[model samples]
Target: MRALMMPHRIVMLAVAAGLVAWIVLTGNWSWLPKYAPMIGQGVWRTIWLLVLSVMIGFSLALPLGLAQASGPWYLARPARAFCTVIRGTPLLLQIWLLYYGLGSLFPGIPWIRESELWPILRQAWPYALLALSLSYAGYEGEVMRGAFASVPRGQIEAARAMGMPRRKIFARISLPLAFHSVLPTLGGETVLQLKATPLVATITVIEIYAVASRVRQDTLITYEPLFLVAAIYLMLAGLIVLGFRWLESRQPRRAA
Candidate 1:
């Protein structure tokens, strides 16, 4: 296993080195220095979108996932159906539906149109945030549900036998175990959520992808801007992976 893993790691490093070398050799680096500030702002926007959406999504996922996993039919069924619908549908469609479809109808409601919140609702960010949050919640909720279910029954039973309250058992044993089990998966989902930020560009959020697109249009150099954006996203994903790996390492190891 060590030998096999060593070779795979070497190959990955070699591929990354080759790509960087190629980009440096062939690409125009001048544009980067000139537009660094704009690109930086775009990157910031992308990061904001990812952080806000994922935080909101994960916050909501906790309860929704628990409901789906353990609640009565009245609660679980609807929660399950909500997750199914959001996960089954394409995210882009959800964004469009929220941004354009519902946005168009907002004016017909005189109260909403006249409210102070109307200014916020008129912007693309709120809708994009909502859509992304809902999308993340739908997927993450299922992951959480599965993780919760995968907790060892023996642990819960032991806690109960000790006369621990249900809430205490859940808080001390079940939630932590499930969370540890699902941490890696949640990390992967976060990376995926970062990728999904590009979709907000369609609704005029002006994120990294949007900035790259503008650069391409203005300079008429398609590949350069795209390549740069790809490199940035790759770096961001690498950081996210490393962060998760560090968290995983800090977690107490399971008994053999």
Candidate 2:
């Protein structure tokens, strides 16, 4: 794979200059020092939440897409249904249901409350993470299904003709091709996933958006905090695009 893009030095420096100018010249800075630590924590939490959920969701998408694309009817039907339902529903509704409905249900269950995992089960972040991960999986599952289906049947037949076992054939051929097919799309999905991280703030996760909200509440300066939040997300999305473009550049070359 191509090295992950670090982005352009000149453009990045210019953007940095612009942001610094904005921070210094335009907005209220008095509150920043007091809340700097909280903002730092929020930024870290947002990035962590996005990265972990995407990794978990993409891992799930592989099997889910494969099941729908090529597995037996039983597996395909359920996988199809899952993708349909998740894609159909509003992500906000799913988060609320999981956090309010299932979270409340878990506490009422005596065994769950008594279990060793009760502490984790009581928190909002776990539910938020679950909702985000499943949302990513649901969307990416369809992308992967299409990618898997597009893999040339001739390639599979060639491998099979060479006496390659089914498992080996998939490892050597299908998965990689499908992943490469979807690599460009995966970056866009990741950017969407990053935007979705703000939704977790509604569940008391205290991500960067929530930090912005707090700044607005405490300082009553709306535009400055919002400007910063927008800038942060914009930078993140740019990074994701550049990173994926680099991956696309690294795709294996085929000889004519």
Candidate 3:
């Protein structure tokens, strides 16, 4: 992966420079102080969205992932299908479908039509979080399935030979080992989900990107707020990378 990406370094650098130049040309740097607070507010919203969505996705994905890996065909097949369908589509469309399409069709339902749930769903946060969680769950489920698959058949057989119950074998050996093997993959998914949070703006979640758009609209300035938002995103992404790297490093590595 590193080798394949090396050639893109210069291209990425050029793009960054061009973006900075555009910002400098179109947006006054001095006004950055004025809009900085609003941009920060947006960043907080972005962070909240990431945290909430990832928590929901991570919690759901574990069971879904395990079931997908080892459950009976009847159970596994539908979970696999659900993951495939969600992963196959763009998240933006998923948000639109949940918030507007199915939302319109189920208008008679209390949650869909006229209750407090309506207030939550009518805004962009719920739909955005739902879409992000579902999207990440699909990818995370694959990661977990692969991790579970990496467990040694011999180990399971030995546990069975020792007369350990299925639950004991899974709880004591399978889950832990699989998790160790898949830590890197899990970390990558988490990081990807973090970056993807900004897409919530498409549904009106008012994430960093949304705030930048608003600032641009209000001030007719092109890029200062955008630059600030990018900086904030970059910082958050860096933190995620570092945190996950630390997690991956701290976990015990499996033997080759």
Give the residue spans of candidate 3 off by over 4 A.
1-27, 105-107, 110-118, 254-256
Error of 2 at 254 (Å): 2.8
lDDT of 1 by residue, 1-256 (tens): 5764787788998998998899889887667777889899999999999999999999888877888878788988888998999999999999999999889999899999999999999899999999999999999989989988888899999999999998998799988998899999989999999999999999999999998888888777788889889989999999999989999999999689
Clashes (N, CA, C under 3 Å) per candidate: 0, 0, 0
Supply candidate 3's per-residue lDDT for 51.
Answer: 84
Mind giving the per-residue lDDT tens digits that candidate 3 earns over 118-193?
Answer: 6666566777778888888887887787778779899999999999999999899998898788777776777788
Highest TM-score against the true fold, candidate: 2
- Prediction RMSDs, each to the true structure: 3.1, 4.9, 4.7
TM-score of each: 0.88, 0.90, 0.83
| Residue pairs whose backbone atoms clash in candidate 3 | none
Compared with the true structure, model 3 gives a TM-score of 0.83
Better of 1 and 3 by lDDT: 1
Q: What is the lDDT of residue 154 in candidate 3?
A: 99
